[model samples]
Target: MKELVEVLAKALVDHPEEVRVNEVVKDRSIVYELSVAPEDMGKIIGKQGRIAKALRTVVNSAAAKEKKRVTIEIL
Candidate 1:
């Protein structure tokens, strides 16, 4: 999960090396916190948060295959 977020974020950011993903696991859900260079934040988020929503949708779909609940937070 972390790797997925990292790869996706790196692909969207200008400073790919600065992309970071942190995972927090709970009993029923997983939280992925993503971070990127300040300059690349907007690129990852996209206009009006469309990109972020799409990313979250993809993550959720993947998690669904494993019967797991996952959430993505960009910070």
Candidate 2:
């Protein structure tokens, strides 16, 4: 899950090397915290947060395959 966020974030950001994803797993859900260079935040988020929404949707779909719930937080 962390890898997924990292890969997507890297691809979206100007400073790919600065992309970082941290994951926390609980009993029923997983939380992925994504961080990128300040300058690239807008790019990752996109207009009206559409890109972020899409990214979350992708993560949710992937997690559903395993019967898990996951949330993505861009910080």
Candidate 3:
């Protein structure tokens, strides 16, 4: 799951080396925090957050098979 977010974010950013994904497991859910270069924030977010929404949707769908709630936060 972490790898998925990393790959997506890295592909969208100019500074691939600066892309990072942190996973935090709570009692009932998993949180993925995606961090990218400040200058590349817009690319990750996209127009009116469309890109971010799509990214989260993809992650959530992939995690559905595991029966766990997953969330992605872009930082």
Instruction: Give the winner by TM-score.
Output: 3
Error of 3 at 9 (Å): 0.8
Candidate 3 lDDT (Cα, 0 to 1): 0.92
Candidate 3 lDDT by residue in tens digits, 15-69: 9999989999999999998889899999999999999999999999999988889
lDDT winner between 1 and 3, please give it: 3
What shift in Å separates residue 18 of candidate 3 from its native position after superposition? 0.2
* Candidate 1, 8-65: lDDT as tens digits: 8888878999988889998889999998999998999999999999999999988889
Superposed by TM-score, candidate 1 places the C-alpha of residue 24 at a distance from the truth, in angstroms, of 0.7
Candidate 2 residue-wise lDDT, 7-74, digit = tens: 88888888999998888888889999898999999998999999999999998999899888999988
Off by over 4 Å in 1: none
Q: TM-score for model 1?
A: 0.95
Ranking by TM-score: 3, 1, 2
TM-score of each: 0.95, 0.94, 0.96
> Model 3 Cα displacement at 8 (Å)?
0.8
After superposing candidate 3 on the true structure, give the runs of residues whose Cα lies further than 4 Å from its correct spot. Answer: none
Cand. 2 Cα-lDDT: 0.90
lDDT of each: 0.90, 0.90, 0.92
